[model samples]
Target chain A: MDRQLVFELPNDLGCIEGAVEFVLLRCEFCEEVSRRLRFNFRVSLAEALANAMLYGNGGDPAKRVRVEVTVESSALQARITDQGSGFDPDRVPDPTAPEQLHRPCGRGIFLMRQLMDEVHYNDQGNAVTLVLRFQDTEALLREASA
Target chain B: MAFQVSREGDVLVVDVDGQLIVGNRQELKTRVLEELEKGEQKFLVDFSSTGYIDSSGLGVLVSLSKKIREQGGELRLSSLNEDLRTLFELTKLDSLFRIHDSREEGLQGF
Candidate 1:
């Protein structure tokens, strides 16, 4: 399956769920891959969008978030771009550190990296791409159909 | 996430349903903080019905756990499914909060 969906979300955090749901509906995969995709993609996308809105755009509802999702034969890629002066993602400290464990913020990027197969940021740091790879897609398709 | 609250002895038990993410995490934080302000001590967050939670949701939980501890209260989590459990484990937050396999287990010594 090769399909792409592009949409824009306002910098409102409330829009994350709706946008994720929209992408999930358009994704096509075998049963097992679909199940994992739902959970992984939902969490990863929500984290990515939150980072874009809260940090990249500084929670400015006036800014727009551009989302472009592509479903490949064996993976799904989502790119989220925001309008703001980006911060260095490398500077984000690990949330699990003993000192930072109690801190309420700074976990979104960490969670994205954990859930997505690949996480990338543009040089400007205003945009991010999260990729999820399917496991044994050919075998899973046969199993699903049988 | 939507919640059902009840009192199990001195512990305030909250049953969360639906997804917990950035949008409504503050609501959960506010509700618990309100309870903390009212002098309620022990707390249990039951997530059997919760399907998913993003980083923001987990962050709120961490913040609440800290605040409750400062109030000399306790916080426990119960009934996280496999996916949620992995999230906690992956983030190494499983060590930060007291998690029980069942609500009964959580409420036993609370």
Candidate 2:
């Protein structure tokens, strides 16, 4: 199945949950991946959504967050775009910094990298795309159907 | 995060359970600060049963830590699982606060 859904939501941090649920709904519809894949998908998608809401809009509620999901033969691609001027994704501090451990924030990208098969960003840095494989799509479909 | 509080001598131990994400951030912030304002400065956050927390939750912890330190007291965390501890270490927050293996160790501070 090949399809895409684009959403323009206010850049409020609260919208992250709704975006995650939206992805989950798609996974349920695909019915082709396993519980592990589902968890991985949720975590990766949540990180992208969080980035869109936090940095994309500068945490401004008035801005807009755009998300698009495309399902393909071999992979699932999700793109999250935000309203701000964009940023340098390369500069995100490594959460593993020895001096930064107790601080409590700034690990979304780290977790996202750990969960998704591959993660990349567009030149402008305002849009991030996450790719997931369909290695066990048949099993996912059967499991979801049953 | 939903919290249940109890006092042990001069310390106020807050048992925060549930997902501490952006959605519940405000509640956690308000409640923790409220407890501190009521003169319960020495604090311990027991996450023994808490399973998840996001950046926003971390933000609250930072804010409270600053507030508590400003009041000439301290904030300690206890019972952090592997994942939660990873999050802390990843952000390098492990160096900022005092962490203990158990509630007793955190409370006694001896």
Candidate 3:
């Protein structure tokens, strides 16, 4: 099965939950798949949206955020685009570093990457795409990847 | 977002009851900082009722922990679900913050 959802939102943190819930309620998955998807997708989405609103839009209420969700049999993808000048994701310091642990500002992108199977930032840096495959196949593909 | 603040022994326990995301993450900080302003220390945040949290929420916790520590106080977290625990571990904040399996355990030192 293939499903797609698109949500255009104001550059507001309050709107994030509606976008997440609307798309999640529409996804039909088994119990295991659902559990993993709920945890991984929800966290990644929230982080992405916060980045879009805070950094990309600079917390400007006039700007907007566009989110697209695509659910295919093998994988799921969410793209969040904001209306602002993009930034260099590489410039973001590692929050996990010993010295940076006390800094509270830079962990959003790192969490998105860790939770999602693939995290890609657009060349402009204003948009990010998060991908998660349905089956990590830890019970099967461990040998292959390793 | 609602926070249940109470005193148990000398520790101030806050029961956070909502998804701590970008929107309401500040409420937690404001309330805790207020308590800090009032000279209340030894805080334990119980998350048994919290359903979701993002990086912003994590940032608030880190900042609060630092603030409390600077004030000669402590911020302890308890009752995080498996996903949240993994989140803390992945960010390496599990090393920075003292986390307990339950509220009782979190209150042990305080």
Candidate 4:
């Protein structure tokens, strides 16, 4: 396991570009870990970052969001920590039910859960860690390269 | 995201591509509303090329539909992927907008 790459960004749209930059950088790092697994990591990372920028900060523009990416064993993990109080992960509305599909919020967390292998939040709810593990046995050989 | 606009008889079709997120919310809203305000209320937003979308993206769609309806016009979405369809279902937004499995169907519905 390598030392993690950490980035702290303001909870505002102005720092969004910077967050994306860090996301791409982490994607490149993940790619190097497994040349065969080019899993749309950048997209997933963006989803996570967006959640931190939006809900994690609780609309407090004065706060900041921190993202840490690391490669541990065979998994690539990106953890995002917000400066404000966190919400219950289970409280996030499920986007699969026919009754709740039109709302503007809650979709980012859904997408992140779908794209990543594992999504877990800290006890205090202020931090979340998303882990992506490259499936071995060549199952991702074609899809990863694509 | 990038959008392509074309006219199908009286209906205007807009093809949207790329991921729809908070970053492009304003831009997407402006472009789609601009077309709707131009008297092209019978519109179909083709999402065949759209790969992913978040809540902010969904907001743009909801707001656009509301804006068009206020002017006595309508907006429709077509060719949503499974992920996006699931998203629409989760947010309960599917009921608010007319969705078609294909662009041809969406056009014919208008």
TM-score of every candidate: 0.92, 0.73, 0.93, 0.73
lDDT of 2 at A72: 80
Give all candidate RMSDs, comma-separated.
Answer: 2.8, 5.2, 2.5, 4.6
| Candidates, DockQ | 0.79, 0.36, 0.89, 0.42
Give residue A52's lDDT in candidate 1 (0 to 100): 87
- Give the better candidate number (3 or 4) by TM-score: 3
True contacts kept of 3: 0.90
Q: What is the interface RMSD of each candidate, in Å?
A: 1.0, 3.3, 0.7, 3.6
Candidate 4, A119-143: lDDT as tens digits: 8889888888888775541456656
Report lDDT (Cα) of residue B72, candidate 4: 91
Per-residue CA lDDT of candidate 3, range B1-110, in tens?
A: 47889999989999989788788878999999999999998999999998887888899999999999999999999999998899999999999989999999999867
Clashing pairs in 3: none
B-chain TM-scores per prediction: 0.97, 0.93, 0.96, 0.93
TM-score of chain A of each: 0.87, 0.83, 0.89, 0.80
**Each prediction's Cα lDDT score?**
0.87, 0.76, 0.87, 0.73
Report model 3's chain A TM-score.
Answer: 0.89
Candidate 1 residue lDDT tens string, B1-110? 38788999999999889977778888888998999999999999999999998888898899999999999999999999999998899888899999999999999977
Model 1 stretches astray by more than 4 angstroms: A30-32, A135-146
* lDDT tens digits, residue span A1-146, model 2: 33877777777767776777776676665664654355566666767777787777778877887888888877788888887788887888776666555455667777777667788888888888888878755656668789
Write model 2 residue lDDT over B1-110, tens digit each, in one string. 38888888889888878667777778877887888788877999989978776766776888789888999879999899877786677566777779898999999852
lDDT of 1 by residue, A1-146 (tens): 33888889998988888888877877754355765677777788888888889888998979999999987767789999999998789999998898988888888888888777899999999999998787554475778799
